[model samples]
Target chain A: MEDIWKGLMHAGALLFGGDPGVWEIIGLSLRVSGLAVVLATAVGVPLGYVLGSRKFRGRTFIQVIVNTGMGLPPVVAGLIVYMFLSRSGPIAAFATDVLNWWDPAAAPHDAPRLLFTVGAMLVAQVIISCPLVIGVTAAAVGSVPLEMRLQARSLGATSWHEALLTITEARRGVMAAIVAGFGGIISEVGAVMLVGGNIEHSTRVMTTAIVLETQKGNFDVALALGIILIGMAFVINNGLTALQQSGSRYER
Target chain B: MSADARAGKSEPIIVAENLTVRYRKRTVLDVERFELYEGETHAVLGPSGSGKSTLLRVLGLLEKPATGRIWIDGAQAGSADREARLMMAAVFQNPYLFKGTVAENVAYGLKLRGVSAREREDRVDAALARVGLEGTQRHSALQLSGGEAQRVALARALVLEPRILLLDEPLSYLDPLIKRKLVADFSEILTTSGVSAIYVTHDQDEAMVVADRVSIMHEGRFVRSGTVDDVMGLPTDPWVADFIGMETALDGEIVDTEEGIARIMVGGQIIYACSMFCPGQKVLVGIRPEDVMLFAAQSEVPVSSARNRLTMRVEAIEPRGALVRVALRRDGLRLASSISRASLRDLDLEPGDDVTVLFKATAVHVAAAQGVPSRL
Candidate 1:
């Protein structure tokens, strides 16, 4: 209990005391997770819309794979991204062999050695968050009644326009899905650590910094980072949750 | 010009040819041809799952027929053709309003057509007023009751002023009082707007009230299609007769013919009917309850043009709204007569009372039905 009080005090001081180190870590965490969510949403929404609204062969199989991916361990995603970004990985080999085959003078014939950079952390976080976005978005879109689309089409909406109307009807649920995706990757530590390597001044986000500070016997700073991470998650999630609740009455 | 001649002169706004829809291995609809003339209300009436709604969907271009050609305004149009689709609008059983204000919901289709905002607002207001829901533009559409929601839905379609309106049991979900009012309002709106419409319903009364012509569908096929009185008054098939509320259908054989009338043997009782069936032919005689007049048996028989009169013992006296249905039986022959409550009171009729039932020979419809039993 006393440690918790001391940790809260340290957290407040760090946030308000012009501490560049803590702010940088916090800023990096927000940037990586935010970018990851945006990228995931760009791909997930349309894919989820198709998966939710369309019927074709192998749809059930794809749905099952996506549902399984929703519960996938973040460390496994980190490991997979780490492998692809590694110097001798297939992606790097392709970049050097195929991409540079016709341009020997191309800068950085490899995949730019992104294994221990912010790019690697973003890739891993996106993998961790994408399935969540897709799964929730699919469920949300599926929950919109078929009559909505039929009525829209009967009112002169083209097939594409009808789909847009359905998506608009499901906006609240999609917003919830996006929030869930952001929440999934925001405070995550394992994937970012494996891919980002907790490099100081480069790739150290709040969660990774917390682990390093704890390992170095700097308990106060670690606890402060943990506090800040929880505060950030709580504030963001609650803000989005308020938004979701405001429009909830019209959902059904 | 006469109304008939005018109707003949106007081209059909929508035409469907060889429309067939199959689900799995079973065919749901196989309509060979259907036409909706301009400024005419054509109703497709049937019981549930009779493919009436499917036919409407195919005509509205909401569903592509398995094999068919849809012609809108004399041009062949595919189901996915947007310009053709925009020429019509539909209101379904449920309103399916989006999450927005009533104005927004009503303005959706206009916005899709890129109507100017000012024109959209004026049209939306006019449409809402037509449905008797004026001054409700800013209300949340999701907050409306079922009837109000449905009215808003109607306004949404009317705002577009489509060349054709497709209504698939739009009033089926409302309460009786609301449905009655909406039906009157809808009939007036359709008449005043002169929009060609295809209304699909299982309700015969609604079909009679709102349609210029009606097609009775059974098992995905139209068994009979004509003017409302023609189809309801003179059903040529036993199934169609029974479906159209004929209270009594008796299986009999034609025994004698004189001039335009035929004497039929119905359960050892000879009955005269105006039919073309020759002697020795099996036929079903249909009688609407309203067409039969009941008189107290003890009173002196009054002279009338009715050629068929028989004393029947009353089996039951059932009240239907303001009328009483007197179910009468004589030997193996059973019949029903509908009389006003005042007539019931004047005659003082009761169960087991003897009453004389009289009907004209022309009131009996004779259809060739080989083995149908008497239905009361």
Candidate 2:
């Protein structure tokens, strides 16, 4: 209890008293998670729309895969990304060996290494969250009535116009998908920790920094970081919730 | 030019040939040939599960037929053709309003056509007025009642000014009073706007009031297609007669024919009919209830051109809207007569009163009763 009270005081100081180290970690965490969600949304929304709206062969098979991926563990995703980006991994070896054929005179050791970098963390986070976005979005878009699409076409809408109208109708659900993707990645510590190596000033994020502080017996600092992370999630989720509710005025 | 067009008549706006639609192994629609004349409202009348809605969808370019070609204004098109679809509009059974205000819903099609904002507002207002929904542009579409939402749906399609409007039982979900009002208003709008339309419905009364031509569909094919009077007054088959409200169908053999009048024996009584059937021909005599008139049994037999009159005891009297239906029975022969409420009151008739039933020879429609058993 005493440590929790101390941690609350430290959280306030770190948030408002110009703590540069804590703020840097927070900023990196936001950047990595934000970019990862944005990338996932870009790919997931259209793919989900196609999966929801059209009936073709193998669609059910793909939907089953996406549903399975939605339950995937973030640590497993991190391990998979780690293997791919490691120095002696397939990607590194492919880049070095395959590109060497194009530039025989270039240095053979010039292959770009991605392990322990922010890019690696982003890849792991995206892998952890993208299937969630797709699964939620597919269900959301599928729930829109087929009559709405037929009505759009009856109103002389082109195929593109019909898709746009359907997406607009499912706007609330799609917003929920975006929030789910963000929540899936922002609170995830294992993936970012394993892929980013949590180096200070470069790769350290809020979750990883909290783990390091707690390991080093800095209970107050660890609790403070935890508080900040929860506060961030609360504010972002509330903002999205407000947006989702605003769209209800248009519904019955 | 076709013969009708050469004679200065309206030309066909849409023509479908060999339109067939199948679902797995069941064929839902098998329209061989259909034509919608310009500025004419054609009604497709049928019972439930008759595939009338499927026929409308195929004609509206919302569904592609398995083996067919559709030409709109002499240009071939299918469900995949955007330009062809833009030339037509549809209103379905449910309103199916988009998520927005009435103005937004009405202006949707115009917006898709890239109409300017100011023009869209003007057209939307005009269409709302046409549907008698004036000054409701800003009202939320989802907050409307069933009838209002349907009016918005109608306005949404009308604002586009499509060449043809396809209506799939648009008023089916409304209450009786609202449906009657909408039907009247819709008829007037179709007449005044001169828009070619195909209205699909199961109500024959509505079809009679609204359609310039009607096609009676059964089992995925049109069993009868002609003017409403031609189909209703002179049904060629027992199914058509039964469907068109000719409830009294008596099987009888034509005993004699002279000067287009045939005497048929039914229920140990002779019935005079205006038919071309020869003597000894088995036939079905279809009688419309509205054509039957009743008088007190003690009253003097009215001297009129009607050739059939019989004494029948009233079995039951049922009130149907503004009219009353009296069921009559005599010597095991049953018949129904639809009369005005005033007539029923004037006669002071009851369930046991014997009355004289009179109907003209022209009212008796005779069809060959080969395979169809009598429904009497």
Candidate 3:
């Protein structure tokens, strides 16, 4: 117990004051996650809007794909990326030769320390979470009444303007989707840990750091990051609830 | 605003020709043909879910018709999207208002038409005042009552001053007094402004009172379309006759019993209906409840211009506030008449008391509506 407390203090001091390398790792984590979320949103939000607003063949089938992706195991994505990006494998020439990437039958570690990079972890988080964003956004935008849509169009609004107005009207639902998507990536474990390689000052976000600390028997450090992760989740949920309530006035 | 224009009504400004619309292989609206003339309030009267709204939507260009054509303001609407959308403005049954101030709602159409902010605000204020809701610039649109919401919708459409005003049951959500005021406001606007309008409603009397031409739409087509008097007085179909309160049809031979009066005897009872049918010629008799007047025992009112007045025993009196329906029997034939509560109270009328029924000859119409023979 005393060792746990002592380890906690050391980790806290290292996080806040002592080493610039820890802050660098945190910065890398934010950069990678931010880049991934932005890319996914750019591709997914338009897809969701199209699915919700337009009608065509295979829509339900595509919706099924989105729903299935929402529960996709993160480790599976990490393994797939490991095989595809590893040295001596399908795209091996692009990776470092240090990776043992030739055989698909081997375990995930046979791929390489490409997993030790921040980009790999970003890919994993985006893969694990983008489906949730698309699904929630589709549901949100679909709730806009068809009457209002027709009314706006007849009043001379172009199609793009109609889409913009709908987004403004359904702000609460879209906000909730964003928060849910953020929570998904920020708290993800299997994909981040597997693809991130859990290096102390390289690929470790708060999620991966917690996993690594637990492995090293540093209960205090792991517990501290866990608390922070849960706190972030709490803030996001409350913020979304506030926004939804604020926008509920127009919902007839 | 010119009395000359109102009196000498001209041809229709807008015409919908063969406007058939299909939704997923089912015919939603099949108008075949209908037109709206200038300086006239043309009403599309139909029951609920009777394609009235679909026709409005197609006319307003909110939805494309599967097959049809619409010509507005003397321009063919087939090739022009921009001009067509600008030509007409519609107010839906449930007014579609934005989450904004009343002023913003009214200014939506003007803004779409490229009006500057200054001009938009001015026009919005003027439109609001015209709709009898002045100084409500900042009021939230959703906070408005049913009547106020409709006014805001009209204000939104009227701000642009489109050539055609299309309304889909605008007064459905309003109370009677509010509806009357809204109608009056519409009349004032129509009189003051030259904008033509197409109104859709279910109220028969309201259609008669407000519209210059009332078109009855049913079963994917309009069965009767003409002036209010023409449709009501000479209905083309038995369904229309039933729709317009034509209750009983009795067969009788017209007889010139008096100097300038004729009587109809139905089922051997002398139903002395006032008419100018040729003597000894058979004719059908039609009487609406409101046109028939009843009096008990002695009709103290001076007998003048009432060609048909007879003593009958009151079988029943059903009071419906402003009017009381008195059903009576005279010479073994049951006759029903409508009288005012004031008249009933003045006559001290009750059931089983003999009364004199008075009805004018010109007021009682003749028609070969249903299958009850052309000459009775």
> Which candidate should be chosen as best, given DockQ against the real structure?
2
Taking all chains together, each candidate's TM-score versus the true structure is 0.86, 0.87, 0.78
Residue-level lDDT for A204 in candidate 2: 96
- Kindly give the stretch of ten consecutive residues in candidate 2 chain B with the minimal lDDT sum: B1-10
Q: Which residue pairs does candidate 2 place in steric collision? A: none
Local accuracy of candidate 3 as per-residue lDDT tens digits, B210-282: 6777788886678888767556554556676556654344456665557545676655665565455565666
* Model 2 complex DockQ against the native: 0.76
TM-score sort, best first: 2, 1, 3
After superposition of all CA atoms, the RMSD between model 1 and the true structure is 4.9
| Residues B1-376 of candidate 1: C-alpha lDDT, one tens digit per residue | 3334546878998988898999988999988889888998889998899999999988988887899898999999998788899989999999999998999999999999999999999999999998989999998899999999999999999999998999999999999999998898888888889899999998887888888888889888888886665566556666776566554467789897889799999877888888777788888666777988999998987999999999999998888777888888888677778899999999998899899999999888777774644321
Q: Candidate 1 has what TM-score?
A: 0.86
Compared with the true structure, what per-residue lDDT tens digits does model 2 show for residues A1-252?
999999999999998998999999999999999999999999888888888887889999999999888999898999999999998788989888877888888757576688999999999998878898888888888998887888899898887888899888999888988999999999999988998999999999999999999999999999999999999999999999998888678677
Worst 10 residues of 1 chain B by lDDT: B367-376
Q: Sort all candidates by lDDT, best to worst.
A: 2, 1, 3
Higher-scoring candidate on TM-score, 1 or 3: 1
